[model samples]
Target: MSDVAEPAPSLARLGYSERWKALFAPMADDDFVPGRVMRIDRGIATVGTGAAVVAAEPAAHLVKTTGIGSRFAVGDWVALAMPETHERAIIEAILPRTSAFVRRQPGERETGQVVAANTDTIFIVQALAPRGPNLRRLERELVIAWDGGATPVVVLTKADLVSAADADAMREAVGAIAHGVDIQVVSGHTGQNISALRSYAEDDATIALFGASGVGKSTLVNRLVGADVQATREIRDSDGRGRHATVVREMIFLPDSGVIIDTPGMRALALWDADDGVSAAFPDIEEFAHACQFRDCTHTAEPGCAVLAAAETGELTDERLDSYQRLRKELEVSSARQNDKLRAEKKREDKIFSKAARRYWQSHPGQGGRD
Candidate 1:
């Protein structure tokens, strides 16, 4: 729901499966109509309700009770209420999300921003043209993807820009850090390896494409969906930076295949409650830490630190260790900030409740009022 608008298709066409059907069964006989959020723009959401896609206005009460993170997102299954007086349908409720790609909301707000929800696979797209792949960014991407409970596959796009030998070398370099994750090299221009990427889109599955701007994410989505469904713009030739061509997050259904959710290029992918993701992204480093002499080793200058020792003996790269430590510390700091924010909000709520209760008692003396 970050930006843009799109026409709705059916819920089944949007990759609604048995899992979603079962999850929605609880509200079967209710007046609510089930739909999947295809896109949301300017407080209005485009939802596909099994029968047809339509624009729906989110109910104010739904937004208030669920908070921001629980708000409607692309790929979310929602209950809709249609009124005769209104042109747009009303989003009454959002079903439980099986998975979500979330990040820390920017600028001093200690909260999570769910970019996309209910995704089964996340394509960590990194371009090979703009000075090859950024290993550090890839690590960050993997951490969030793992944290979001989605299987991540590294998609090395712009393969046409590099020679076959160079491509292989870059793949190996990326493989060193990616660990168990799959890596695929494809070119939107040449149409190479595009078919191989179809495996994730099979059987009503939902895939999310994530990367920085100008990484050919939109172009790749066009190829996957076999149409120019998303707009494409050229990256700046001088700096290799891409403009935000796809300014919004959207879900597009591929004919005879599964569905894909294309999101705007993320400029800042800060971690938000991604401890499990960090561990999953850097399993090797965690394994080494188990053998450290100190139980609370910071892995910086601690003596008998197995991680640092491994780095010294050339078993592990110092850069990779540093990335791990940096991300781990970031998570710790973010968690503390979030906890503080929650405490403050709770305190404010308690104060307001106490004030309201005192006023009620004062006004109703017959109801055992203390005043």
Candidate 2:
């Protein structure tokens, strides 16, 4: 027999860090495979393992025990089991996530949706063409991104369409609202200032692009990837909305740097679990809150409330406080609704299990079954 060892390309190219290794050590053995989820279509996920990109279905036990609604999304790191029959690879288990981007769907029904998982940074893109800019929407996106535990970088696209002075003014206006976030103005057509945006993506990091429709998110993704990975379209003359160019969340690896996930443009980004993000995004208001006489000051009508005092002294804008209070109340209501839904779902599942047990006992007449 030849004395040569085959290269373990999969393990070698995984390039997991010490932190990731420790995170996975408790859940994975030495022989367990590691991969990053690149795309999720329907229920099947395409994972990038070092050996090759493989299509996989989550294990049946994982599917049954964990709600599919809350499990494995695009950009998740997962553990894989060797294929038994050389036909299908099984996603044995999902490694714990470092961060996830989640939002509540806009509708009568109360439901939370996970947009992406394990993202390191989020690029909040907004177009400066057609209309100047939607400051309110930009603020909302910032809050959601901050809450997701990722650094939010604002990308103001369509700079070539506007005059130089107009672009500077728009950037200044956005910078005022953005507070401490980094903002870049780039034109996909002219390739202006694209390098500033590229500097964020380094090795072993993942960045996600999020923006409203017609904001040139897909176009920017195409430019960054240096190829037509996503479809692009022009916005309507009447409104700033463009056609839904990207329908799914997919991850693409850069030539030299890390991965980027492009998502469908969101029209409504309702907040879900964003209390910390709200505080971080509105640091001015938070700083004022610390000076309040009472620790629990609502800042609405309380005397000695530093927030109201700031607004009166022109240190804080009334609009800013109003937006902050509105988002806080929305988060409160959404959290309560989510808890209620979870309780209701649990009760429903319990009832179904009880009924099934009764039916089984009736059929067998002497069988003892427990859930």
**Which candidate number has the best TM-score?**
1
lDDT of 1: 0.86
Distance from true position, residue 166, model 2, in Å?
1.4
lDDT of 2 by residue, 325-353 (tens): 99889998988987898899999999999
* RMSD for each of the candidates: 3.8, 5.7
Q: After superposing candidate 1 on the true structure, give the runs of residues whose Cα lies further than 4 Å from its correct spot.
A: 1-8, 66-69, 292-305, 347-371
TM-score of each: 0.89, 0.85
Model 2 scores worst on lDDT over the 10 consecutive residues at: 1-10
What is the per-residue lDDT of model 1 for residues 70-171, given as tens digits with 9 covering 90 to 100? Answer: 588898899888776778888888898888888887764577888899889999999998699988899999999999899999999999989999999999
Residue pairs in candidate 1 whose N, alpha carbon or C atoms collide under 3 angstroms = none
Q: lDDT of each model, Cα atoms only? A: 0.86, 0.80
In terms of lDDT, the poorest run of 10 residues in model 1 is 1-10
lDDT of 1 at 34: 86
